[model samples]
Every structure is written in C-alpha cells, then in structure tokens.
Target chain A: MFAATMAAVLVTMILALGRAVLGPTTYDRILGVNMAGTKTVLLIAVLGFLTGRPDFLDLALIYVFLNFIGTLAVLKFIEHGDLARNAGDGE
Target chain B: MLEMTDLVDLALLLFLAVLAITIAKQRNLFVVVIVMGFYSLVSAALFTVLDAVDVAFTEAAVGAGISTVIMLATLLMVGTEEKTPSQPRILPLLAVVVTGAFLVFGTLDMPHYGDPQAPIHQHVAPRYIEVSGDEIGVPNIVTSVLASYRGYDTLGETVVIFTAGVAVLMLMGQALRFRQRDGDA
Candidate 1:
C-alpha cells in the first residue's frame, strides 16, 4: 500500500519537474518547484511510516517550513529585486 | 523481488540527474536556481528513502532553504542572465568526465550498501549503538552520537556555518539592494 502511494507521489514529482524544466515563464517555474516541494513533503511523510519510524514526520514538518520559506523568499527577491528593502519603498 | 524502497530510490536519483542536466542547460539564472532547489528536494527524498532522516533534514534545510536564499541574493547583486563563458568547454568537460570515471572506478572496492560486515559498521558504530543510549541518556542514538560522542565535530560545523554567513554579509551586504531593472518578473 505504501509503495503504491510512493509510486504515485514520485510520478507526480517527475511531472512537476518537467513543468519546471519546460517553463516559458518565471512564475511557471516557481510554481513547479513549489509543487515539487509539496510532493516531497508528502513523500517524506509516507516514507516515515513505510520505514516504521513515524518520527520521520518531524522531518516532514521541517521540510514544510523550509519549502514555504524558500518559495516566498524567491518570489520576494524576484518582485522586489532586493531582500532588504522596506515595503513602502516603491521607488 | 526488489524492495519498493529501491525502486523509489532509483526514480529519485534519475530525477536528480535530469534536474542537473536541465539546470546546466538553462541560461536564465532565476530558473536555474529555482530548479536547483527542486533538485535538492529530490535528493533529500532519496536520503529519506535510504533511512538517512538526519541527512535528509539537513539537506532540505541547508540545500533547499539557506542555499537558495543565498544564491538568489547573489542574483540580486549580479543579475539573472548567466554570462556566456569566453573559453571553449571541451577541456573542462574532459576533466569532469575523467574525474567521474575515476570516482566510478574508486567505488569498485567499497562494500555494497547495507553490508553488515562493512568496516564502517565494524568500527565504533557498534559501541555507539549499544552503549551510547545508556551513557549519554539520549533515547535516540543518532542524537547521542552527534551531540555527545562527536561533540567537537558538530561544534566545528556550527562555527563554519557562522563564519560563512558573516563573510557573505561582509562582502555582499550593501550591493543587494533593489536595482531598478530587477522589477520585471
């Protein structure tokens, strides 16, 4: 059962990777990478249970945090062109 | 019958190789860096499948997280178009192929994965697994070994990361501000 689910997730991850590689727009690539990160979190969670170590969920939780932070950071850098600028400085 | 873990591991490695090739082929630095983050995610999943949870965690945090941010910040200073190298790629490609071949050759004498008789397992691993829990009072032996048995190594790693962060700030701290041309998505 776990194997089947993992196979599905891995398949989807490949699709997401394809989306990233074939991207004609920057947002498409960001979305693809973001989707891949989400699938990886799922893969890690299932992997924890499959390996008989449910504590692997702890790592999944961290991946979730890191993935979100990374995506948002990329978007912010892309939009603002600077990570340190204040929000009100539009000029 | 091969285990499902092995299949999953193989697929993940394949994805990693594909990502590497695509990232190399991309001229857009933004796309390249984002795909690099995606590559890290696949490798981290592979580490998890191999039962290296700690390694996966660090890879996700450092490889996917901190490294992506640092590289993107670098792009902010340097711009997103990868510069075309003036030199021919033939010699460097030859060097990489040779080094890769040497690496493959070097692996010939290593024990296969999960071999119980491997020298790594024969070393202090046995004692750490058996006695460290009792001695260090940490239920997770991996934690005990990393925090207690190998305390100095962890401390050194901490110092190295700290130094790297400070040095990066010293060098690129001011130039990272928004350039007028960076606003187009």
Candidate 2:
C-alpha cells in the first residue's frame, strides 16, 4: 500500500516537473515547484511507514518548515526585486 | 526478486531523470530554479528510500529549502531570463557529457544498493550501530553518530551555516545604507 502511494506521488512529481519545464509564466513554474515540495513531504512520511522507521517523519517535518520559508522568500523576491527592501515600504 | 519498494525507487529515479532533462533544457532562470527544487525533492525522497534518513533530512533542508531561497535572492539581483551566451554551446555540452559519462563509470564500481557486505556497512557503521545504544544512549543512531562521534563535522557545518547567515545580513545592511543615502540626497 505504501508502495502504491509512493508511485502515485512519483507520478505527481513528474507532472509538476513537466509544468515547471513547460512554463509560459514564472508563476506556473513556482506553483509546480510548490506542489512538488508538498508531495515530497508526503512521500517522505509514507516511506517512513514502508520502511518501518517512524523516525523518518522528523525529516518530513523539517521539509515542511523549510519549504514554506523557501516559497515565501521566492515570492517576496519576485515581487520586490530586492530582498533587502525596507520592511516599512508599502507593498 | 524485485520488491514493491524497489518498484517505487525505480519510478522515483525515472522522475528524477525527467526533471534533470527539463532543467537542462529550460532557459529561463526562474523556471530553472523551480525545476531544481523539484530535482532536490526527488533526490531527497530517493535518499529516504535508500534508508539514509539523516542524509534525506539535510538534502531536503538544504537542497529544497535554503538553496531555493538563495537562488531566488540571486535571481532578484540578476534578472530572471538567462542572457544569451556569446560562445557556442558545443564545447560545454561535450564537457558535460564526458564528465557525466566518467561519473557513471565511477558509479559502476560502487556496491549494489543495501549490500550487507559493502565496505561502508562493514566499517564504522556497524560499530556505531552496536555501541551507540550503550555509549551515546540515543535511540536514533544518526543523532548519536552526528552529535557524539562526529561532533567536529557537525560543528563545522553549523559554523558554515552561521557564516552564510552573517554574510547575507552584511549584504543587506550595505544595501540598506545605500538606500538611506539615496533618500537623503
């Protein structure tokens, strides 16, 4: 059952990669990457069950936090064109 | 002899291959960064399947997380679309293909996945697994090995991360100063 779920996740990852590659807009690529990150968290958690190592879930949690920060940073950089922009500056 | 786990691993490998090809072909810097994140995610999953949970953790954190943010920050400094290369692509392509072929050849000599008798499994790994419970008393062997056995290496890694954070802050500080100067003018 875990294997089947892993296979499904792999399929989604491929689809996301395809979107990232075929992107006509930057937003499409970013969204695809975000989707892939979400699937990856699931994949890690499922693999933990498959391998009978529940400890691996720690990795999944780390990925979750990191992915959120990364996506937000990307969007901020894209919107502002500078990461060092003053926080008081209105968006 | 192939198990369900093996099938999943193979499918993930296939996905990684597709992601690599797409990343190579994409010219847009933004798209490339996004595809690279996918590549890192798949690679981390592959690491997990290989039973290297610690490796997977670091890869997911560094590869999918920090690298993506850093790349985006770089892209903000440098525009999104890649500038057209003045030089021909043939030489670089040949160099990459040759280097890749050599890498593949190198991997051919590597022990099969999860081989019990592999040199790595034979050496410190067994000792760590055996002694970690009694010595370090950590349930997670990875944590024991990283924190106790390999303390220096982990410390070095932490120092590097700290230095990077400091460098980024310094750059931002300079930028802020420049902006203030402009405003004053």
Candidate 3:
C-alpha cells in the first residue's frame, strides 16, 4: 500500500518537473516547484511509515516550513526585483 | 528477490534521471532554480529510501529550503533569462561525458545496496550501532553519531550556516544604505 502511494507521488513529482521545465511563464514554474515541494513532504511522511521509522515525520515538518518560506521568498523577489526592498513600498 | 521497496526505488531513480535531463536542457534561470528545487526534493526522498533519515532531513532543509531561497535571491541580483553561451558546446559536452563515464566506472566498484559485508558497514558503523544505545543512550543512532560522536563536525556545520546568514545580512544592509543615500540626494 505504501509502495502504491509512493508511486503515485512520484508520478505527480515527474509531472511537476515537466511543467517546471516547459514553463512559458515564471509563475508556472514557481507553481510547479511549489506543488513538487508539497508532494515531497507527503512522500517523506509516507516513506517514514513504509520504513517503520515514525521519527522521519520531523523531516517532513521541516520540509513543509522551509517550502513555505522558499516559495514566499521567490514570489517576493520576483515582484520586487530586489530582496532588500521594503515590503510596503509601492511599485 | 527484489522487494516492493526496491521497485519503488527504481521508479524514483527513473524520475530523478528525467528531471536532471530536463533541468540541463532548460535555459531560463528562473525555471532552472525551480527545477533544482524539485531535484533537491527528489534527492531527499531518495536519501530517505536509503535509510539515511538524518541525511534526508539535512538535504530537505539545506538543499530544498535554504539553497532555493539563496538561489532566488541571486536571481534577483542577476536577471532571470540565461545568456546563451558564447563558446561552442562540444568541449564542455566532451568534458561532461568523460567525467560522467569516470563516475560510472567508480560506482562499478561500490558494494550492492544493503550488503552487510560492505566496507562501510563493517568498520565504524558496527561499533556505533553496538555502543550507541549503551554509551550515548540515544534512541536515534543518527543523533548519537552526529551529536555525541561527531560533535565537532556538527558544530562546524552550525558555524558555517551562521556565517552565511551574517554575510547575507551584511550585504542586504549595504544595499539598503545605498538606497537611503540615493533617496537623500
């Protein structure tokens, strides 16, 4: 059962990679990467159960937190063109 | 007998290969960064399957998380579109193929996955596994190895991360100062 679920996650990840590669717009690539990040968290959690090491869930949680920060940083940088720019500054 | 786990591993490896090829072919810096994030994610997954949970955790945090953010920050400094290479691709391609072939040849000597008698499994790993429970009393052998046995290395890693964070802050501060000077003028 875990194997099947892992296989499904792998499929989604592949599709996401494909989208990221073929992106006509930066947003499409960002979205694809974000989706892949979410899938990775799921994959890590499932892998924990598969391997009977429940402690691996901690890694998944870390991934989730990092993924959120990374996505936000990318989007913010794209919008502002400078990471050091003030958040409230109007373009 | 190849188990279900092995089969899943094979599938993941195939996906990683495909992702690598796509990333190599991509020209957009933004898309490359995103694809690299996916590559890190898949690598973390692969590490987990290899039963290296601690390595997997570090890979996800550093590779997928911190590195992705750093790359994006870099992208902000350098424009998104990748410049076409001025030099011919043939020399680089040959170099890459030769390096790849050498790596494959190196792998030929590696022990099969999960082989108990492998050199790595024979030496320090056995002692760590045997003594960690009684000596360190940590349930997670990885924690024991990284924290107690290899404390200096872990401390060094922490110091490196701290230095990087400080460097980034200093650079950002400089940029902000320049902006303020412009505003004052």
Candidate 4:
C-alpha cells in the first residue's frame, strides 16, 4: 500500500517537473514550479509515514511554511517590483 | 536486489539529473532560478527519504526558500535573459568533463548506503550510538551527535550563516542610507 502511494507521488512529481521544464510562459513556469513544490511537500509526508518516522512531520511542516512564504515573496516581488522598497520611496 | 526505497531513490535521482540538465540548457535566467528551487525541493525530499531529516530541513529552508528569494530579487535588476557567450570554450568544457569523470571515479569504491561494515560506522558512529544518550542525555541520537559531539562544526556553520547575513545587511544598509540622503536633498 505504501509502495503504491509512493509510486503515485513519484509520477505526479515527474509530471510537475515536466511542466516546469516545458512551460511556455513565465507564469506557466511559476505554476509548474509551485505545483512541483506542493508535490514535494506531499512526498515528504507520505515518505514519513512509509518509514514509520512520522515524528519528522515537523520537517514537512517547515517545508510547507517556507514554500508558502517563498512563493508569496516571489509573487509580491513580481507585483510590486521590489522587496526592499521603503514607503517613502513610493511617496 | 533493489528494495522499494532504493528503487524510488534511484528514480528520484534520475529525475534530479534531468532537471539539472534542463536548468543548464535554459537561457531564461528567471526560469533557471525557479527551477533551481524546484531541484532543491526534490532533493530535500530525497534526503528525508534517506532518513537525513535535519539535512532535508536545512536544504528546504536555505536552498529552496531563502536562496530563491535572494536570486530572484537580484535577477529583477540584472535582467531575465541570460547573456550568451561569444564562443564556446572547449578548454573549460574539457576541464569540467575531466573533473566530473574524476568525481565519478572517486565514488566507485565507496560503501553502499547503510552498509554496516563501512569504515566510518566501525569508528566513531558506534561509540556515538552507544554513548550519546548517556553523554548528552538526548533522546534523538542525531541531535546528540550534531549538538554535542559535533559542537564545533555546528558552531562554525552557525557563524558562517551569521556572517553572511551581516554582510548582506551591511551592503544593503549603505545603499538605503544613500538613497535616503538623496531623497532629503
């Protein structure tokens, strides 16, 4: 049962990598990488259970937080054009 | 006789190689940076599966997260398209190929993963496993090894990260102050 689920997760991860490699537009690539990140998060969780070391879920949770924070930071950079822009700069 | 985990590990490593090649072939700088993050993401999963959870955590946070953000910010000002070299330098390519060949050659004699008879296992690992609980009183052997046995190494790593953060802040601080002065004028 764990083997089957791992296989499924591997397939999804491969597909996500494919999309990241072949996506046409920048947005397409972003979406693909983001999907790949999501799949990676799932892989870590499923792998934890398979190994009977689910105590490492803290690592998975950290990935989830970092992934969300990274994607948000990138999108905000894209939307606003700068991560370090001061409020007075806009004024 | 490959176990299920070994088979999956091989498959994931193959995928990582393909991703690396694709990243190398890409002329789009933005895509390269993002895909590098994806590569780190997958590799972190691989590390976790290999039971190196702490390494995986650091890889995901530092490799995938912080570096991606920093590189993307730098790329925004540097332009998205990669600059093409005027000509392919065969000497550099040859040097890289030679280095890669030597690295692969070096791996040929290494013990298989989790081999009980490996030299390192015979040396310090056994002692750490046997005594770290008593010495460090940590339930997690890995934590004991990292924090207690490898205290200096961990301290050095922390110092490296702290220095890097400080250096970045220093550089950025000068620029921000300059901009503020310009604004005042």
Best by DockQ: 1
Model 1 Cα lDDT, one tens digit per residue, B113-177: 88999999999999998898789999988889889989999999999999999998976655554
Please list the C-alpha lDDT of all candidates, in the order they appear. 0.89, 0.84, 0.83, 0.85
- Which scores better on TM-score, 3 or 4? 4
How displaced is residue B2 in candidate 1, in Å? 3.0
TM-score of chain B of each: 0.82, 0.82, 0.81, 0.87
Output the worst ten-in-a-row residue range by lDDT, candidate 2 chain A.
Answer: A76-85
- List the pairs of residues colliding in candidate 3: none
Give the per-residue lDDT of model 2 (tens digit) for B56-166: 888888898889888987887788888984554798989998999999999999999778989999989988978899999899988898899999999999999999999
Q: Which stretches of candidate 4 lie over 4 Å from their true place?
A: A84-91, B85-87
In model 3, what is the error at residue B59, expressed in angstroms?
2.0
Error of 3 at B58 (Å): 2.1
lDDT ranking, high to low: 1, 4, 2, 3
Q: For residues B1-185, what per-residue lDDT tens digits would candidate 3 score against the true structure?
A: 97767876887787788778877777777777777888888888889888887788888888888888888888877888888745557989899999999999999999987898999998899899888999999998889999999999999999999999999999999999999999999
TM-score of chain A of each: 0.91, 0.89, 0.90, 0.85
Q: What ranges in model 2 sit over 4 Å off? A: A84-88, B86-88, B136-139, B152-185
Q: What does DockQ come to for candidate 3?
A: 0.69
Candidate 3 C-alpha error for residue B78, in Å: 2.1
- In candidate 2 the C-alpha lDDT for residue B153 amounts to 98
Quality of model 4 by C-alpha lDDT: 0.85
* Best-first order by TM-score: 4, 1, 3, 2
